[model samples]
Target: MHSDPSGSTDRIEKDIVINATRERVWSTLVTFFWVDEGNLGTIDPKAGDRFVAHSAKEGSFPITIEKADHPSLLSYRWASAQEGAEPGEGNSTLVEFTLTERQDGSTLLHVVESGFASLPSAMAERAVSDNTYGWEEQLDALKKSVEG
Candidate 1:
């Protein structure tokens, strides 16, 4: 887990090794990250597709897919601050996930969420702090979901 709430480094990076093949890890990552249990609809992710991630506790957030490279990478832009607002250059952060296959068949999962520096200083700091913790929790769950 790495984050700088001082606005100098406006991104969060997390890496976890899952005891699973890249294919299985990729499947779990795509499914778990994109379609949460509370999500309202299904999505076959691809570049340019738009969707809303509905969280019962946090509310809905609009997301736009930037790139979806099968089994290796997926990147998206999300506006997390305002509920139901569309993702844009000024209001959104880019979230990217990269998967690498290890020689031992375990998968290395890396995630980075950036663009916080563009947001208001207070918002940027809070977002970085919040997401730093969020990613750690989320990745742990993902590892369990894939390994199980």
Candidate 2:
């Protein structure tokens, strides 16, 4: 976990080694929501592409693609649990996925969710705890989705 210099935002990061190629991992990431198999609805994988992710637990939320570099990195900004909230510095967080290919044909998937401290204190703490657990489950699901 890392935080910005002002301590106004905390970053939660997790890494997992998946028994899949980088291409396969990248395809799984940009094409669909890993936590839920729903399509992202015509993602261009370019900056400024807007998409919605539907989760059984979290419902639907908007995401703005911040950066997309094929087979390496994809980042997006999404609102927190607030309903109908727009993604931005106060109400949203940045989610970034970085892929590294290994010599044994496995891919290391790194996920980071940041900007928690920008929310209210209670919300920020809860989000940090919730997202830490959420990412663990999501990463497990990702490994299963690609490996199985």
lDDT of 1 by residue, 1-148 (tens): 3343563677789999999998888777666453355344334579998777777766778788999888899899987666678888667899999999999989899999988888777667777777788789888888877887
lDDT of 2 by residue, 7-72 (tens): 444879999999999999888776666644565532559999876777776777778889999989
TM-score of 2: 0.86
Native-referenced Cα lDDT, model 1:
0.79
User: Which model scores highest in lDDT?
Assistant: 2
Q: TM-score for each prediction? A: 0.88, 0.86
Residue 6, model 2: lDDT of 46
Q: CA lDDT, every prediction?
A: 0.79, 0.79
Let me know the TM-score candidate 1 reaches against the reference structure: 0.88
Give the lowest summed-lDDT range of ten residues in model 2. 1-10
